[model samples]
Target chain A: MLKKPPSVVLASFRPSTYPRGYASALHSLRPCWMVFLNILILIVVCGVSSAVVLAEDHLAVPANLQVFDTPNDGGQSLTVNWAPGALDSPDVRYQVLVGDAGATDVAALKVVAEFPAHTRLVKDAKGAWWTRTAERNWHQFTIRSGKAVELKDGTVYTVTVAMLKGEERIVGPLLQAAPTPNWFNWNLVNNLVLTLIFGGVVFFSIAHARRRDIFLRRIPGLDAVDEAIGRATELGKPILYLTGAHDMSDPSTIAAAVILGRVAKKTAAYETELLVPHRDPITMAVCQEITKQAYLEAGKPDLFKEDSNFFITSDQFSYTAAVDGIMLRKQPAANFFMGSYFAEALLLTETGASTGAIQIAGTDSDHQLPFFVTTCDYTLIGEELYAASAYLSREPVQLGTLRGQDIGKAMILSVIAIGILLATLGVATQAAWPQYFLDFFKDVK
Target chain B: MDATIIGAWVATGLTLFIFSFLYKDNPLFKLAENLYVGVSVGYTIVKTYDTVIVHLIWKPIVENQEWTLLIPVAIGLLMLTRYVPKAAWLSRYAFAFIVGVGAGLAIPRTVSSFILKQIEDTIRPLLMLVPGEGVTFSWNLMNPASSVNVIIVLIGVSSVLFYFFFSVEHSGPGKMVARTGVMFLMIAFGAAFGYTVMARMSLLIGRLTDLIEYSDPSYGRPTLWLTLVTIGTLIVLSRRSRSEPPDSH
Candidate 1:
């Protein structure tokens, strides 16, 4: 049908038969005044509403919703991640909903966490770049064992995300995830790489030392070992040795035990008495074996006493008091304090000093080093304590290990120099590259 | 008297006995020392039983049906095999396992936290650019994170590390570096020694406070009585020692 001319239509806008001017004008514009235009407007409004209803029903909420066990973790954790949607903003509310596996009803799921959509994004996570599970533009929420959630390991759970914009709530697809314990945390790959490098360096050094002489600077404390032993033999006084207050698990304790072997051998050869008092029973047991082996090696098995490496109490001050008693009573000509010591360092060393014994101490405990140095005639500080066994034994393996550690320190020094230079230059030039260099030394997890 | 008051009296007497050792090795000091050793060993045994046996091994196996706890229990039993000389060789298995696992765990963690983290912290930028201003070197000594402190740390770390380098002998320039390292070490040790002296002084203050508290009339003046007894005992012991032959020791 042909539409009416604008002039006729305007002229037809007049008062109707029933009402006042305003209502009559509105009445004339619809119904028959402009039939085709009115019909077209109705169709457009209906179509738009229909399309909106369809979109609300079918369009996915919080795009690309995924659920998986949190990686690089022990277990009992599940992560829900989704791509950032248009609705994400500071004003909009986002929530993490978790339920038993195969649970489809969103109403049944408990909301573990709820916050503004702009927070908890992938970029907010701490650690190295590779530690992030998703790209910067995604939102991540973790469900772990806490007051809000108790996710059991190896049990599947369904997870979903919900977004609230005003009164409208959109729920995402239900996804299943199981919290399984991981054997190795991939986040510490950098740590693994460093350990491997150091291991390779150590092994290579060991091999090289076996082939040729590796020059190790003289450690005076280690050099004094023999002199101390000889002094004990000359005085006819028993040599008193303490392995400190750690178990056999500690590296310092192990070194002390090895040094005990060397000392025991010399003591047996000289037929000078040896007294070793231990705080840990396990260490006492091990040292007994070491002392026995040393005597056997020196062909003085008959002189080796089972009571020599005896267990004292594992108490710090009590053990120190007991050792002090021994020092005063027996009056050992020489005192060897090795391994890690605590506050009792001064108590033992001072007592030994007062007894006029030739005191020699080797320990990595920096806090107690001052006491050892002040009271003892000879003190091995820091790594020197670790190197004492190697220096005394002169064995290829021990020598190589020392050389390897030295090389490792050198490598570390080189890295520090290079990193500082790069970092300084980056700051001056306003470059993004230096952080990558720094990240190499950063602990990933 | 109440148990707390009695405990105070006993503690005061023991403290006085121990203090007698400062004068000379006497019977009182020896008695106190032996008692201290005995009580500490007893405490350790009880603590080990409670923690290892009841909590770690027994509770888990009974409550949670955690059979995995048995493995560690078995290993611990293997460690006890050392008492049997013939079976003593078996204890090496336990030791080996412990050392291997400990080293494996320690190496990675040490590398991560001790080595890597320390290196990262040491290698920081000497300069920083402030917004709307040019690059700047912070000279604020009060701020530990400032560039001046950073430079000091750099020198300290490098010199100390160089000193520990065993392969290179401390000679010529190496000797200079080693000397610088020694200076730094002495400074560090001196500072630590002073700090520890303060700590020890505090400990002494704590002990003195206890002694003073025990000397109150409500506690029956245990500290004063104990001190008199200790002094008398020391004098008698010294007299006896002087009377004895010099070759008796």
Candidate 2:
């Protein structure tokens, strides 16, 4: 119970916070000798330093205490480990106590976790060598903010592992650590490798496209673009076009806008009316500019109606209702539903279908693909929507990017085949080596 | 009638008018559609006003003294310069900044989350290692993660990837794989259609239940009176339509 600043008896017990290596580092100085030497030095150093004394000298102090920041996390966590002491038993409980760094008050540390000895040991942890200890089967525990003192990022915390036998308590030397925000997570290295490979492929493909012709197979949905515009022109009716409900930020919406330029060009050449309704103001503005540019390129700038690409309500069903109203009243000959859609996809496409219009839909949102496929005369599947622009514009850069994406997909397919073969062989042989391949592809930690 | 009953009658009347679209487009349906659009737009404007002007911009600048918010606010205002013909070029700066930042931020996350994660999931192993029973190939059809289902999924995914490969032509073995991919796609769509039909039926049930509740004597039977009023209005409108000349356009 002698708590008069136990720094005299326990100050030497302070293990250096930063360690050169994680094993056999903490010096296990005898408590009796530490007290004798600490007093001998403190008597010469100062009276206040020698004021403290020891309690329960026979209690076994655990050794090799280590506290460090949890690696590869967003921070705010510290891990603690201490070797199993001589008092380690099945019924004996181990309590992990924590406090601010340089805390001298022995009783002030808060116990964050209490568990039976031999439980939560390094041996019981994951079978990775990185997680194991080289010296002893040390008891391990993680300290986070909750049910204990808050461990903030960039703040040092002192952790001590204490063993409890009934009412008897014995604590290890205090170890300090500070949680820090790590800029990069090494856990997602596999994902990074895949991304780098795909990026390199894209760049190489773009460069190669400069010299050679890139072959692109036919997309039936894109092929009907001309036919749909021609039908609207021959019928002397306007073409109703939607640039989807999303803002300009979405890739699907961007693709839709690019395809809109091509459609506007075709309509400008054939002298057909085009109506582009938008749910987002930004997309409306962007599409308006695209339509104008398309018309100017086609030598018919006068035909580009500024009001043709208009903003309806941002609310989904309200936009749907307004579009349905326009469909009924104006009676467009062909309808184009492009970009990402939500529940309103079926509502718009179904109404367009009932009107007997030559409907062609394109969207990357797989959830709405079923409705579009059923309701529209021609439907572009997921990747086909992205490819629609390159198919229409025949631009080298865009075509190269599309071909690169296909190559990436091919790489992925090959991986799946190889992964399956590896996994099958690994299972059949009851070997652990296949885990390296599996872990390399594990997208989630 | 009480205001609650009156509101109920209006709501039921409007709902019925929207339902009248199944018959044909008419003045009643158009009235409901216009009202819906107007109310929705009004609600959205108020919400944006509260969130953007009041909560985000005004309150922070006024109370918290967050002057840095005005930098982005100025950039947003720059987008409005497109209306001024002389200053129209300035709007490109705002558009460029937005598109550039949005694409830069979205590309990596999209690759990691959508592309990489999808590949990881699609390339799963065939056999499972059961702890006590060694390697086991489960044939349980009910378990989606069973070995048989894993092989099926592998085939489905591979064939689909092959079908979408634009660089390669669909011929010989590739054609058969493409056909398989189409079959899988159709099956997925059929299941989705069935699910949607069930969802739509549930929505219908909910509406019908609400109508039944409004038909209670406590609510003064708004559903019954509204239906009669709607039917009477439709009859009168049709009679007038029959007398007048049809729209040429």
Candidate 3:
């Protein structure tokens, strides 16, 4: 026969119903025994009820767990997602667990991520699913933080999502995923499409440009270049040109080289002395070829000096010091600071300014634009530097590239306009379609 | 007496010598400048040898037994053929490979990071001011500052893009938009200039703080001693230049 606990048995029994001898003995012990028994009963009742309440509070396991390799990545990540259980509460959280594939032991799994409850709602969601859903509830919680960095590529992994309340947890069924290296990232499909479209437009424009004249706007900076060269010629002083601080690989440096060709041709025609100092050896070699070509094109190849384009130290400040020395000593009538520059920009420009040289600078470096604008007589800001090269060269390919860039900008503007209109319509009428229309612009990843 | 103190003194002297160029391009400034250039070139050569020759090429091939790396190693060695008059054309192959690979790699990344990201950022809804909030509009327009900012940004981006459009001539209405674009560009340039000025000033403050620290007695007043020596050297060089005849160009 089973016996109840001492506290429960004591509560059910009474001393009065016992025999006279037993009753007399019990009377003496009744006062103290009843007090001790009452305290023990209270302690046992509280402890048992609290444990039961804690067991009841344990959250239900998350349902419909899914794991897969993250698409359009370098095979370094996996995404785990789960649907919330019916018993999920605000106080409960979900933790994603990862283990080797076919691993059934929950204790062996490692927690990859922990997500607080009620955090599944898309706050700034522009997706069609997010907009169309009337309940405004997330269908599944996506946990991208479950990336297995140490896991080898092509190795399979199992994932589980556990609903947690305090120390108690209930884990969902395991899901398997394998990360494999992808040759091409499909996530950047929009980027690929735009690049192809833009590239096609450029090639078409280039072909068209060869057959006809392309109308290019008057860049004020190009005229200034000619004027500065004329001023240097009239003053019987040399014209100084810098091909910036970058190597030949930089786009800005290439543009600078193109511009240098145009300047060299004019200088050769005028028979004005030209000095070109370079910071990069490769750029120096390329500029030498460009200068020689320009002189040959101008039919003044004999006047081309090999020493005109020479390399200075590649150290930024040292190069700046050398250029500043040239500016002070040579005191060139015209100084051209073209291409990219950093903090040393102001240092060189300030020295050029002190020499009273007619300075013309062109650069896509916005940070250096201010110093050039204040110190130089004429400044080509940002894209104008690239534009000046195309304008000067009148190359069909360069012109075509510029035209393609403009078209790309137009496409972006049209997209923005459509997005704005849709957003306005969505807000005014409280409809889902307009919001869905805006979803195309959102970066899904 | 200590090596660190001597090093600090030397650095302080070199710094002061370089700074003396602000007074005039003297011989001391030239000395310091040349020293900096020589040190920098030497450092670059050592680093390039370690990274390119030792680590990237030799270690991978020798340690990992990656014999396939010899193809790139051969291509790299071909670049040195430029120094040989007869085999100079061989370097063109290396240049072509480098330029081709660089362009192929850069085009996609540049399109994604610069072009697409810029377009994505610009394609935001103009009406939605605060993030994750309903579209806000005010009759006063300026009452909600964020809406006004959004309008300004949209206008700025459109006008600037219009300015760069070459197909259309800027004649009547186009000229007005182009001029507005110029104004925006100028404002951006002005802001950039202000930022550069702040950055330069910060650098100046950093240098000045170092000078002040070096002037402390614990460092044997290296800055003060270096400043005096640089001034004396510059003065002597200026006197010598005055005494000599000017060179004919």
TM-score of chain A of each: 0.76, 0.72, 0.76
Deviation from native of the Cα of residue B165 in model 1, angstroms: 0.6
lDDT (Cα, tens digit) per residue for candidate 1, span A1-445: 1133344444544644654544744665575746676456656656766777677544248888889999989999998889987656787888899999878899889999999988888867755665677887799888898899798998989899998877778898888999988998887887888888888999999999999999989988888999999999999999999998888777788889999999999999999999999999878888998999999999999999999999889999999999999999999999999999999999999999999999999898889999998999999898898898888888999999999999899989999999999999998988867777777788767
The local distance difference test score of each candidate is 0.88, 0.83, 0.78
lDDT of 3 by residue, A221-256 (tens): 878999999999999999999989877677788789
Tens-digit lDDT string for candidate 3 (B64-169): 9999999999997887786787997797787677657766766777676666565556654445444465556633456434545657777888898888786678
Lowest summed lDDT over 10 consecutive residues: which window, candidate 3 chain B?
Answer: B138-147
TM-score of chain B of each: 0.94, 0.93, 0.89
Could you tell which candidate, 2 or 3, scores higher by lDDT? 2
TM-score of 3: 0.83
Residue A392 error for model 2, in Å?
1.2
What are the clashing pairs of model 3? none
Q: Which ten residues in a row have the lowest lDDT in candidate 1 chain B?
A: B101-110
Which regions of candidate 3 fall more than 4 Å away from where they truly are? A1-58, A84-90, A120-149, A270-274, A300-307, A429-445, B128-135, B138-145, B240-249
Estimate the lDDT of model 2: 0.83
lDDT per residue (tens digit) for residues B160-222 in model 2? 888898878898999999999999988988898888879978988998998999999898888
Candidate 3 lDDT at A262 equals 96
| DockQ of every candidate structure | 0.67, 0.57, 0.37
Is candidate 1 or 2 superior in DockQ? 1
